[model samples]
Target: MADDIREMSFEQAIAELEQVVGQLDSGDVPLERSIDLYDRGAKLKAHCEVKLREAEEKVEQITLDAKGQPTGTRPAEGM
Candidate 1:
């Protein structure tokens, strides 16, 4: 259900998405079943994107000196 989807971690969502892709690609599912799987795939894809965007927003890049030592960290974007 939707509640279960929300609880899935990024890795879990991606794993399920991969399984869905494999099933869809196999072309062995009944039309109705395939439709259902496709819908779930869409939701999983959206969830994964949201997780990635959240991680991206929190990402920071380490500033290094000419000697290749990490000096500090700064936001990965919008600096």
Candidate 2:
């Protein structure tokens, strides 16, 4: 299950997290099931955060030259 979450792309993780939230919001789930869903939701949230951070780092690597033109990408910070 841990590996599954780690392999998920940002879109997949966010979709699942939204589903979990909807389920929990409905108040139809049993206590034990709700606890399980919450745990998975937390993991999904963390994975999404990590993916966003990686994307931000990559976007920050764009190197520019004179005339405000993009030259190329440099190595991302904190790689």
Candidate 3:
């Protein structure tokens, strides 16, 4: 399970986070288990946030034409 969590992609992380929330909401887990799940969920949330920010930065770096569309030029090539 630990290995799977470590290997989770951004979408998988978000899905697990959502499942954690559902578990917490159901009030089925013991207090200690709830806390542990919350901690893991927080970490997953942070990882997802970082991934989203990186994707946003990449989008911003893309040059758009006057019509607000990508010009298809690779921006990093010039760097």
Higher-scoring candidate on TM-score, 2 or 3:
2
List TM-scores for all candidates, in order: 0.84, 0.78, 0.69
Ranking by TM-score: 1, 2, 3
| lDDT of candidate 1 over 1-79, digit per residue (tens) | 4778899999999999999999999999999999999999999999999999999888999999999999999889762
TM-score of 2: 0.78
Q: Candidate 2, residues 1-79: lDDT per residue as tens digits?
A: 4899999999999999999999999999999999999999999999999999988776657788888789988777775
Task: State in Å the error of residue 63, model 2.
Answer: 6.3
Best by TM-score: 1
Candidate 3: segments with Cα more than 4 A from true spot: 1-6, 61-79
Write model 3 residue lDDT over 9-78, tens digit each, in one string: 9899999899999999999999999999998888888888877776765653567899999876543542
Model 2 misplaced stretches (Cα beyond 4 Å): 61-79
lDDT of 1 at 19: 99
Candidate 1 accuracy as TM-score: 0.84
Relative to the true structure, how large is the alpha-carbon lDDT of every model?
Answer: 0.94, 0.92, 0.81
Clashing pairs in 1: none
* Candidate 1 vs 2: which has more TM-score: 1
